[model samples]
Every structure is written in C-alpha cells, then in structure tokens.
Target: MSLPDALAASILSDRQLRPEFEAICDCGGRLAGTPSERRALGLVARLGEAATGQPAMRIPTPYEGWSAQEAALHLLGDDEEVELACYPLLRSVPTPPRGIEAEVVAVGRGTEAEFAALAPELAGRIALVRHEYMFAAGHLHRRLKYEWAKRAGAVGFLIAGPLPTRAVAGSSGRGHEDGIPALGISPEAAARLARTATGHARARIRIATEERPETTETILFDVPGGGPEIVVLSAHIDGHDPAESAIDNASGVAVMLAVARALAPHAGQFRRSLRVAIFSAEEWALTGSRIYLDTLPADERGRMALNVNLDSVAGSPNLTALCSGFPRVAELVEAATREAGIPVGTFLPLMANSDHANFAAHGIPALRLVAGFDDPASHCRHVLTAADTRDKVAETELRAAAIAAAAVTWRALTSTDSLR
Candidate 1:
C-alpha cells in the first residue's frame, strides 16, 4: 500500500519538528538518571500527548543507576608526568583510592585478533584501543573491547575517541557486574601513552563513581486503530553527558514526534494501532527497551506487528535500515521507501547496537533507521563526542527522515499480509 500523500505532506511540513528537536537538544545530554534525562522525558511526554491527542501511559522500570564523580588519567614518563583529559565510561568500576598504575598496551583497533595477539602482555596492564566510526558494519564496539581487556586479565581499559581533543562517552556494558575500570580518552592522550624507547608506557587511572538502585520510565502514546495489532515507533531519550546528543537520538525523537502527529489523524484507516515509545537508559546497553519487552506479557508482545526504531537518524543525508536479520522486513521497508520517493538502503545483519534489537529478539520484525552508515566523513562520526549538537543536523535532513519513517509505518499499518 502506498503512503497517503496528505500524511506525507504533513510530515514534510511539520513546523513542530525543528522546535521539538531543538527543545530536546536544549535539555542537554539526556544521560539516564540525570536531571537532564528527566527534563527531556517530561518534554517528550508533552510532545507525545500533543501529537497523539492522548495522555501518555508511563511504565516504570527499575535499573542499576550510576553516575561518575571524577575520572583522571596521567601519563608517567622517566622524568615527565602529563595529565590528559578523559571521561569515565558508564558503569566503569571505581579505581582504588590511590588509583591503578600500570603499563599501557596498545591493541590498535582492539579487534579479536589484535586482542589475542596481545593476550600475554595484557595481564595487569591497561589495554588501549581506538574508537572507530560507530555507524559502520565492521565497527568493534567499545564494550567488546572492554570485555576483551577484562578477559585478558587487564587491570584497566582505554578507548581513544576518533575525534581529536574530544573524549568519547558510552556505556562500559558492565551492567552491575564486577569489571575493571574503563575510560574514553582523546587522541592526544592515546599518542602520549604510546610505548617509549625503554619499554611499555605506564599510566595512572583514577575513577570515582556512585551506583544505586534507580527507576526510569518508558512513555507510551497509543494512537488507536481499528484492530488490536500494533506497530511501534521508538526512539531513545537518553545519551551521554558529553554534548547535546542531538544526532545520536534527539533527531530520532523529533522525527518520531512528527510522524506520530501526521499519522494520528489517519488512524481510522490503519489496520494496526501505532505506539510511539520514548525509551530511556538506551545508552546503557538498550536497558529501557529491554525492560519494556521483558515485562510485557507474551501475548501482548505477540500482538506487535513491527518495530521501526529511529536512532541517530539525521546526522547525514544517507539513511540505512539495520534490518535485524529479517529479509522480509527489509523488502517491506524498501518498498515503502521507494513508494514514498525516499532513498533508504537495507542491511540484513542483526546488530544489537540499538533498541530495535530487543524487539527483534522477542520474535518481532524490527529495524533501526540510521544515517551515514559506513561513511566516515559524515557528521555522524562526531557522535559520542562533544560535537553531537543541534548544529550537526540540518532541518532538511531531519524532515526527510520523518517522511521516510512515516512512509514505512503507514505501509506496515495498512498492509494486508501478515507481518509475522
């Protein structure tokens, strides 16, 4: 089925898109459990209600809450000691009061083979790895690198951000487990830690964090249709504290709001209801969505027809759908995008990098719409750094993404074939 031109036009002409996007960005990085995150959630709840003309249903979820107090790194040489800038990865274990002083081992890209080759030397040493462009096929996640370091008996882990002078930020993926200290450093720091003529370079890492029981909520706006089946459009509302997190997720949330606003008036024509889910703690290994799916009854979850997760959707003009191993779902997305005159490519591999993966894990057809996959030069490369602000996203790019999302969602809602 083709997308209704009126809905498409509404999505394109959404005056609220830019305002909502900027509002979310102004909330600062919506780090889970922070005041900023709470503010963003409150704003999103209002926006969602405005779009769907219904009050939001909030589902409370419990999770391990964590916040960093201080993180410092010092490169120690024979006669010189240099302090470099660094940020603690989320859930990174706090170092001892005096901190951990150890030799640094460079593992380059921190691939499996690279970690294997440096296995013997990693024990009691700090593994240094580089953060690659995250929106790529072969990118090795910082979490994997940290796990490799831990498995190798490393005392600490460091990931150098791709951008110079900017420290990276993300989850350590340790998730309430015992793990070594991990930090994201700038490129300059990585170079300073390179091996000297004498032997391996040594550095001191000190990190302080507080962990406690925390609760966050997922906001749901249901635009009811004629049937019980549902189609979900989700976007993460949380991100690291480094910057605005505009491109990584604020863009997604903005576009989701626009699509919902355009579709709510036409819900009577849809065969399935549309649920706009604003999730939190997504940066912590997709925690919010995982909890949402886990807590939902099996029968209710089975009623889900498809999940179109928008994440980092507009840093670049190029958009690709991470199809989560669903070939049929990919075909449907392609047809929908084509019919809408929007260019969206599909990659069939299942990437557990976003909230959509959790939906796919529950046997639902799911896909993540993202921008600038495999394009290093795109503004998407600035994600996870301090540069992920509203300036990085263009108004045109955000609107196009909204139109594409609306098209795909409309197609799924009106399709006669079984989504399953």
Candidate 2:
C-alpha cells in the first residue's frame, strides 16, 4: 500500500501502534521545564524529522526555574494528615515554615464578591475553599479566587477537588512569586475537614522552594514545497513529575509523528506548507505559543490558514472537535471526519486551554481535536500526578485519532481556498 493507504491500514490495526504509545509512556512524566520534557522534545524532533523527511529545530522558551526544598501539610488536631497538592501560589512564600498558623475558615464558594465580603473575616485565617463551580468556566475563575484568597491575608489555602465534569484539576498560580501555599484536597477529605472545623482548625503547612527566571524555547518545523500558506499542527512536549505523560500529551506527539510519516510521500502535493510546532511550557499557561505568536512577522502570521491542535487523543471512545468562532472550519472538520468514517461532533467551548489558545487569542482560526470527553471512566486524571503513565493509553484509539487528524489536516491544507 502507498504511504497514506498504509497509514490508514496501520491505524486500523490495533496492535501496530502500541509500541509508539509505549515509547511515549515510558518517558515518564514530562512536566514543562524538566529534563524529561527536554528529552521528549529531542525524541519528537528526531522522530518527526525521520518520519516526515524534513528538518526540525528546537526553539528556546522563557521559564522560571523552581525547586521544592521542603513541602508538607498536616492538620494540628488529632494528628490528621492532609495530602500535599502543589499550589501555584506556594512558590512565592518564604522558605519552609515560619511558625504561622491561623484559624481555618470556610470561604464558601470563594467568588470575587464572596471573597470581598469575607475579606475582613478571612484576614489572618487559613481558608478552606470548595471548588464546587470553580472549574465551570475553566481555571480563570479558580486562579482569580486564589489571588483573592492570598490578598485577603489568608496565610494558606486548601482547595477541594474532583473538579466538575470534563474538567481536570490544575493550578494557575505557578508564576506567582508572592503567593501563598495552595493545595488540593480530595472531596471526601475536604468534606471531613470542613465538617470538623466547626469552631477553628489548624493547618501547619510548609513549603521550601527556590525560583529563578530563565529563557526556554519552542521549536517550529516547516516542511516546504506544499503551498504558499501554512497549516499549523501543535503539540506540547512537556510532562509533570512521577507519571510518564503518555495520554496527557505524548499521545498527541505520537499522533503528530504518525501524521508526519503519512504525509511524507505527498509532501509536495499539498497546496500549503505544513508547520509542526512542538510548543514548550504549555502546562505553564501556554507561554511558548504566546511567544511564538509575538515573534511571527505580520505578513507570515496572516498567511496562517488554520491551526490543528492535538492534546489528549488516546483512551477516549468518542472524538470531539472544538472549533473556534469560524463556522467554515467547523463545517470542514465535520465533513472530513464524516469522509473518514470517524465519529465526531461539536463540543462546548471549553476554552482553548492548550497551545491553540495563543493562536485563537490573536484571532487566528484554530481547532482542538480530542476524544473521550463523554467517557466518564476515561479522563485526564493522572495529568500532573505520578500516575500519568503510558499504560493508561489505548493503542487503538491513538492510531485512529492520528489517522482522522491526518485526513482532516490534509484536506484542510490542500483546499483551494485558505481557511483563514
């Protein structure tokens, strides 16, 4: 079979793609700014170039270096042990504990007005906040709440999790240099603690960390000879600690590799160039993509036809297409999926929390293709945890997603008219 036909066949053959997924999963947690992430970048650069027969480059990015000297949390009474979940604000506090403990107060929903109302009462207290509706509109609200909580003189804050449906737990206060130590508690644990704090409970938290500002890079690979315009394919090659981020994004990288390989033979046939970007620090607020947008020349930026982003693609039963404001791109994506016999549908505007956000922010047309939002059992659970390993991904789903993505991307890249 030809390359495209072989790609289709291999994608349909479940066992054929397991090795690639396994390789990605084996890389362990590739959190942004970590050595593992750099290694993963190199791996993708090599694999992508080999697959596409095109040159690839590694671009540097700006990142603040951080190191945890000591981090611990425990309830004072009855020696109740509380789990230590990383908070974005904790990086700003002083090293270790300074013998500071305040009364534990429930901040209700921790909204802006709610926080303003309770600001006086929250002064000098450790706030135990609930994440009931925080993730509803993405982490923007949650991040604002954290800032509010910190500004209210709350020495520390604890967030209750298992966020809303289709929402994954994340921290946005990473860049805060003067923030409090925030931690996420399981729902059951948080409920128990909240109930026990009728009068006042004590939380002894300590975090010893170091912060340094530095520059990082985001690599963009361009395959010439297709066309004058370009179709951007993006994936972040970063992972967190402990777990090998096979599903969180390595799946996306693997799919990009597969697509690059499939497109190699027909590199000169398409009417547009293929720009594959391995973005950096996506986990740290889409930093790399934003920088990339800023550096793009005005004329070149306008020439971008469309951005096809692949984040989490393996392990879901149904595929979802998240379209920006443009209706034509959405229609074309739907048509392409239908042509490929792939089950796809429109998903709610979940906010471009990934690399696509930067492009969308600049009014560039973009789409986020994902699978498994409806699958209750399959979600981005081990995202930042040590459990996000390769074993969590399904080879079959990864291959299928890659194939569908290539088909859609190829069609979009070769269309007579520009998608932009």
Candidate 3:
C-alpha cells in the first residue's frame, strides 16, 4: 500500500523532529532524577500535546535514585602515577573518601566465562574489561558483567570504552546493597593501567555519590479509534548524561512525535487507538515501563494489541526491529517498512535491551525499533560516550525511520488483525 498523501505532506513539512532533538540535547542529557531529565520531561509534554492536539497525561513513576558527585581513577605503576578521567556508572556504589587500591586484572570482555576463568585472581582486584558494542550479536550486557564481577569477588569494576578519547557511560545495576563500585574509563586510560610482565599494576578508584527517593512521570497521549484495543507507541525519555544520548533515545522520541502528528488526524477511522508512552528512568534498568506495566489491570493489559517501542531508531540509516519472538509483529513490520520503501532488518529473539521487554514479559506482543543491530559500524557504536551527539544522526536517516515507523504504526492502527 502506498503512503497516504496527507501523512506524506506532514512528514515533509516536518522541521519539528530536528528541533525537538536539539531541544532534548540542550536539556543537558536526560539523566534520570536530574534537572536535565525534568526539563526533557516538560519538553516532551509540550511537544506531545502540540503534535497530538491534546494535553499529555502524566503517570507518576517512583524509584530509588542515585547520583555521582565525583569520580576519578589514579594509576600507580612502578615508575608512574597519574590521575585519569572516569565516569561512574549510574547507581554505582560510592568509594570511601580515600578510595580502594587494588591490583588490576584485565578480564577481557567480562563475560560469565571470562569472569569464571579469572575468578581466583579477581578477589580483592579491580577487574577491567572491554565495553562491547551493545547492538552486536552475542553482546554481553554490562549489568550482567557487574553481577559476574561481584560474584567473582572483585572489589571494583572497570569498563573501557571502544572509542579512543572519552570514557563510556552506562548503568551499573548497583542500585541495591552488595553491589560493587564500578567506573567507566577511556581507552587511553585503560591502556595506561594495562598489566605487563614487569609487575601487576595497582590503581585507586574514588567515587562520591548521593542517594534519595525520586519520582518522575511517564508521559502519555491517547489518540482514539473505534476499537477496544490499543497500540502502544513507546520510547524512553531518560538517558545517560555523558553524551547527548542522541542515538540511544532522542531519535526514538522524535520519530514517535512525527508519527503521532501524522496519525492523529485520521485515527478516528482506524481499528485501534494510539497510546503514546514516553517513559522515564529507562536507562535505570527499564524502571519506568516496569512500573507502568505492573500497575495496569489485567483487563487493561489484555486490551493492548501491540507495543511498537522505538529506541535509538536513527543512529544509522538502516533499522532493525528486535521482534522479541513475536513473528506476527515482525511480519507486519517488514511488510509495512517494505511498502514504505524503507529497508529494515528483523532479529527474532527476545532481547531485554529496551522498554519493549517490559511489555513482552507480560505476554504482550512487542517489537523494538532500533537503528543498529549487527552493524558495528552503526552510530550506535558512539552511543554511551561523549561522541554521541546530534551530528552522528543525519536528517535522511531520521526521515527514513520516521516513514517506516509511520507506515507500520498506521497499519497497526488500521488493521483488523494487528498481531495475528
């Protein structure tokens, strides 16, 4: 089916996506529980209302919050000692004022097997590992590595970035007690601390942080159709602060807004209503979506036909739908994207990388629309680092993703069998 002319025009005239993206970046990186996140929330509400022609609904979501006040790494080798730049992973446990000094053990990729192989050597040591591309096949999540490190008796964890200059940033899964102190170091910094046969190098990691209970909202806007079922268009609003978090999520949100504006006018004739969920604290282990899903009544949960979750939708021109084992959703997405003249890849297995996993956990058919999957060359490689800025995403890339998303969302809204 060809794209509707009206929707096409709306998409063409859309200068809003770029500006909205820039606006989000200007909010200073929407780290959860920070003023930046609050500002981003207000922006989303304003933009969502303008796009959907209605007031946005605010659903309060609460969680224990953690923030880093200061973090640093000091290398102490036989002949040299120098301080290095470091970013503490979100929710990482703080070090004492003087910090802990331990021998460094390079753990390679920090996988379960890697940690196990080095288990004996890890005790009282700081385990260092390379940060793999998040979208690459067989990628081990950093959270699990943190868990593995803790279990291996490592006193601290260090993840070296793929890029050369800046340190990487990610969640530490250290929100609970018994979590280890974790920090992200740049490639250069990691190189300096590398262990040689001459001696086992020792280093000190110092981190200062504060903890509190915080509350934020999941922004939602409802666009009606005649059917009893709803199609959820979700994207997380919060992201890491080290970068613009542009590729990680700001792009997903812009695409959602574009789809909302283009779909809102003709929604009355469709088969399902559109429910836009802009979740917060997503970088904190998909917390916002988890809470939102848990509170839904059983009947309400049953009323959802599909979740078209857009996360990092345009770090590259190519897109992949992480289908989460929902074959029907995958087929529908492929058909719509092809019909819209957009190329997209489909990965069938379920992944818990984004907010979509929360919906899938409840037996709801969900698919994550992401820009990069197997392509290590994709802009996703730059995500979670200071290099993930707006320039990494081209306008054409965002447009193609927007068109494909609009097509798929349009079909889901109009189709009689959304997930069948």
Q: Against the hidden reference, what TM-scores do the models get?
A: 0.99, 0.86, 0.97
Taking all chains together, the TM-score of candidate 2 against the true structure is 0.86
lDDT over C-alpha atoms for residue 98 of model 3: 94
Candidate 1: which pairs clash?
none
Quantify how close model 2 is to the true structure by its C-alpha RMSD in Å: 3.8
The models' CA-based lDDT, in order, is: 0.93, 0.68, 0.88
> Candidate 2's residue-wise lDDT over 1-420, tens digit each?
112565576556534256666676666666665677766777777777776677877667776666556655566666465543433332345434553566677787677778888888888887777664321233344567778888898877777655322112445455755777766555554554563525676667666767778566677678874567888888877755546777778888888777766765676677788888888677666777888888889889888888889888775656777776667777777778777777567654646567776787777788877766555456454454445567667676787788778877888767756555
Top of the candidates by TM-score: 1
Candidate 2 lDDT (Cα, 0 to 1): 0.68
What is every candidate's alpha-carbon RMSD to the true fold?
Answer: 0.8, 3.8, 1.3
Instruction: State which candidate, 1 or 2, has the greater lDDT.
Output: 1
Ranking by TM-score: 1, 3, 2
- With candidate 1 superimposed using the best TM-score fit, by how many Å does residue 101's alpha carbon deviate from the native? 0.3
Candidate 3 regions with alpha-carbon error over 4 angstroms: 78-80, 418-420
Candidate 3 per-residue C-alpha lDDT over 1-420 given as tens digits, one digit per residue, 9 for 90 to 100:
446867867886788988888888788779999899999999999999999987899988999888899998999866887998789999999899999999899998888998999999999999999899998668889999999999999999999998988899999876567788899999998888888878667999999989999999999999888888999998998988887888878999988998888888887778888998899999998899999999999999999998999999887777899989989989988898887778578888999999999999999999999887788888789999998888898877777888888888888888878583
